[model samples]
Target: MTSTGTLSRAQGTALCVGAVLGTGVISMPALAADVAGPASLLAWLALIVLSAPLAGTFAALGARYPDGGGVSTYVRLAFGARAAAAVGWCFFFAVPLGAPAAAAFAGGYVADILGGGHTTMVGTFLVILGLVVTMNWFGLRISGRAQLWLTGTLAALLVVTVVAALPHARPANLTPFAPYGWAGVGAAAAVLVWGFAGWEAVSSLSGEYRDPRRDVPRATAAAVLVVGVLYLAVAAASVLVLGPALGDSPAPLADLLAAGVGGPVRVVTAVVAVLLTIGAVNAYLAGASRLGAALARDGALPARPVRTPRRSLMVVTAGSLVSVTLPISLHTSMLLVTGCFTLVYVLGTAAALKLLPPGWARRGAALAFVATLGLLVLNGRPALLSLVVAAAAVAYASRSTSPKIRIPSSSSAGSIAPKPNTNPVESLP
Candidate 1:
């Protein structure tokens, strides 16, 4: 097959930006504010600073080793197949389970605007899910142009929201800064991780860049700058303009808009929320489908009569639908998903430590590794979900490679020492 690099530097930057932007932007500021008051801005800053090295490390790896296998490939190269499979499974399952939670974020906005409460939210979820599944079914339904437009729309909306809201800012909002105390800032930072969750995804696109060695770094730098400035701007404006009420605003951005421009902005905010949700879920499902196919091809997953991206996508979408029906709270589901992605970040950065050439890049990877490790710890008991998923992947790989035996068969040459299966899945899963 002839391969041509189709993504320009601008395109790559947009992709990275979108990856890191996430659905959290709609609500994170308020959630963090609730946890830390105006001091949550510090958490926003901490996350932004952390993103520099984290994004750069992945960009460096992507430039050096451009492959479809992405972080999983890097992991396989650094630590062998089992670890790679574990990483793959973490991503594959993370998506669908996370999907309902992601979609519901938008649903809340819709319900706020349309007034059907839970019914409205659930209806919105179904519509978004249906759109995403359709978009992914024939292969990635969103064109690059569509994604570019999506990013543009979001960037524009955020800018307008912040700029409009800034004039309303009051110094009194910052008077006591840490009303919840310094411990609250830490709590806020923990909540903010969702906003910064997708930088590691930059690796998957490295192979698509026109000149990855040169462009990956540039794109990543651009993305980090944009993401940092935009996110901080929104968060700061939320605190400064909305003051004490910021924490209680379900649609914080809309509230900012109303406070700034006054009247009837919920509809616009709801539309933005829907667009953001679609883009996020689309990206997750698209990437996971491809990952599933790759995993099956490599033998980490069970072989199907037909192993294709569509098949993988369906399985993932199905899981997402089932997750929506489950009795779990959206908050708990998100935590579960966050745990999986966090573990992926941990493993990806650890892999980068082995794969990158020495000096700044390797050092950056170390920094990312430590940050992500701390995040995993912050996840507390929810993080145990990642461990379980990883273990399942390893077990599946083991089953594929070696047959179970009765007693301790002295035949080490057989199942006991069998060669390992090397492929794994979505892990958007």
Candidate 2:
């Protein structure tokens, strides 16, 4: 486990959970509640249920082709280098866009509590970015350990908050459920994408696991359970206890904790929100760093003049700083983040269906493909920009070629090639 790329199942599970649950838990319930009232629970439940097929498809692929390249590896095996590069671009670019949304979310909560408005939010965004970039500079083993610690602390606090708030739940809160009707459920589900979009992330580090085939699936299953319970408990508590007030609660978890135990707990929850954002951002930075290095090694990206990992981290950090300054609310910015990940999921599932063995694996992959496609469509106009970006990547990749670098395929029946000589410039988390 102390080896550079060797992660235990527990550490792998922590990474997946940390990647999935970010600052969204702090505000998603309110955002969904505003869109669909108490019925937002349906969106939460639907995504959790859908996560099985989505997560399973990616885990199966990761187990089959354990590579630093991750989803891009699968896409290469299935569709060739051009499609792989496109999927890789979607994923690599997503971290910068998504990081600002997550950091801004936690920063907004801090602003609400401490009264600094745009100044506080922007400053918090930069600080979170700096901390994550610095943490990742030490490399993946350190970052994975940090993720394990953060996930444990954050999960414990959430469970405690949910348990304390349960006593305040009332039957009347369930009566007016669906006040905005069924269409709103679809709208709410689109927003919940930010919360559900992380299972693919840890797969990029599949090569880091001591036993990829054995540990990767187990870790994914464990993460699904942990994240599902935490999300459902918080959403149910927000709706049933906070009721109509749920929509306007900027710090929903804080309000829930205060109502349950009273006093200063909101500040504690706000602190936890910042830590959760750090964990989430750290996980993405870990994966994206490895991914950028891999892509560069395979000629999908240009060779950087500097070390790939550091350069990628700096680029992402700089982009996030620019993005954080945009005149958009956190909720709208998050929906855009959702669009980016949904496109990644769509490409990943398509690769799964193409490359997985026939029978239940293919069937499951097909189910994931169809479901993600539906969600992409539901994601509406914001998603068009992501789609356009993906098309551009495909066009860009079609014009270029890299030689002799082959990823293992399921067609070869799980006999993997010797691990690629990942440049010393690359590392996994």
Best by TM-score: 2
Per-model TM values vs. the true structure: 0.89, 0.94
TM-score of candidate 1 on Cα atoms, chains taken together: 0.89
Q: Write the per-residue lDDT of candidate 2 for residues 357-377, one digit (tens) a residue.
A: 787767888988898999999
* lDDT per model vs. reference: 0.76, 0.80
User: Poorest 10 consecutive residues of model 1 by lDDT?
Assistant: 413-422
**lDDT (Cα, 0-100) at 23 in candidate 2:** 71
User: Relative to the unseen true structure, what is the Cα RMSD of model 1?
Assistant: 6.9
- Which structure among the candidates has the greatest lDDT? 2
Candidate 2 lDDT (Cα, 0 to 1): 0.80
- Full-model lDDT, candidate 1: 0.76
Clashes of each: 12, 0
Q: Show pairs that collide, candidate 2.
A: none
